[model samples]
Target: MSDRPDDTPAPRDADELNEAVSDLGETDTDRLEAVRGRNESLEERLPGDEQLPRTHGSPEKG
Candidate 1:
């Protein structure tokens, strides 16, 4: 029942996450939290439960 394709892959680590985030060109706080929640490495690097409105040198909030 998932909308995602069966062939679609889930992010496995911080590198994968960074790549995905980079491609998006915008920070998705909910998605980042969800991924960080599951990925210890990312969680460790990012830390804190608070949402990150911007990341990876993306544009600032105006």
Candidate 2:
């Protein structure tokens, strides 16, 4: 494991790559409709597509 050299792959990135593609992506509902305008619901107790009722272990003992 000393003077070894067999990796191969010297194909330069065709000039820093950028063939052509620009749409100024933003996604995520355009960043929550441009920050603070909405999109913060984390469902603390209910609301936000509620759905919780699985308990199949051992925690309902009181």
Best by lDDT: 1
Segments in model 2 whose C-alpha atoms lie over 4 Å from true places: 1-37, 42-54
Clashing pairs for model 2 are: none
- The Cα local distance difference test for each model comes to 0.68, 0.44
Off by over 4 Å in 1: 1-11, 26-62
TM value for model 2? 0.17
lDDT per residue (tens digit) for residues 1-62 in model 2: 74556785454575433232112224646554544333333334354432655446665656
- Supply the TM-score for candidate 1: 0.22
lDDT of 1 by residue, 1-62 (tens): 98999899874898876776674335677667766666977657784535655556768668
> For model 2, what is the alpha-carbon lDDT of residue 20?
21
